[model samples]
Target: WNYQFLTQLGYPSNYYAAGEMTVSQHLEVSGQPDPYNPGWVGLDYIFGSGMRGGSSGGPHIANLGEIVDSATDPGQFPDRNTIFAVTSWGYGLGNSSGTEIKIQGASPLSGVANANNFVDLFNAACRRSRAHFGTWTCDLLVP
Candidate 1:
């Protein structure tokens, strides 16, 4: 959605603000990253936007590029790339340039099946929430 803005010089077309996708990679975290997981949790990392406070659930999307990046509807969900993760937290504030986003898959459950199981835990949480209304369920606590 590019639009021409009126300028002081009356040119009205000097600047353009087109939105595009950025690239990043996934890596393992070492330090005491998340407070919820005080122990070793095998958390992963990736360079992200300068996301500040109250931006926890934003998606970290990667455009697959060209052939796979074509947008059928120009702008829509699942258009050109996949969301590998979401904005978790900023690593203790300084400059946001070195900030790395933590993916949601890694956990301290310590098992082959525990990794990349947010969907399961989330679904379980939902089910637990539903069942709790009827006194037949428990909390799905993800570790």
Candidate 2:
């Protein structure tokens, strides 16, 4: 994460850590309507890490950084946008919301494609700015 974005999220800067996902989950849309992939669909990848707190609708960035900027609304810094996945459920619910954040199942390709569409629209709407944010209204961004 960039120090500018970090600070904007109300966190102290100077922190840089990376994690490698060690798991992959496959699923079926038997009882559901699959958008990304029709029947017998498979998800990209699912991961688990130790995150205490973060915004629910924030973006999930890849190590490469700035895959697609999605936060383009007011109060959101388009220049600091770098999203690969839409932040989904987490592990601090009953006790906070949940910390087991995972990338949207549509990410890898389908999800990213959908997000790209939004990004494009966002850029057009925000004068060539990202449409999503890693921490738009986040309360905290610390380890």
In candidate 2, what are the lDDT values of residues 62-116, reduced to their tens digit? 3323445475553544434344343343332234354434323223222433654
Best by TM-score: 1
Q: Over the stretch 38-86, how does candidate 1's per-residue lDDT look in tens digits?
A: 6554343323233244444445444444464454565433434443445
lDDT to native, each model: 0.39, 0.33
Q: Could you say which candidate leads in lDDT?
A: 1
RMSD of each: 14.9, 15.1
Q: Model 1 residue 37 lDDT?
A: 66
Ten contiguous residues minimizing lDDT sum, candidate 1:
3-12
TM-score of 2: 0.30
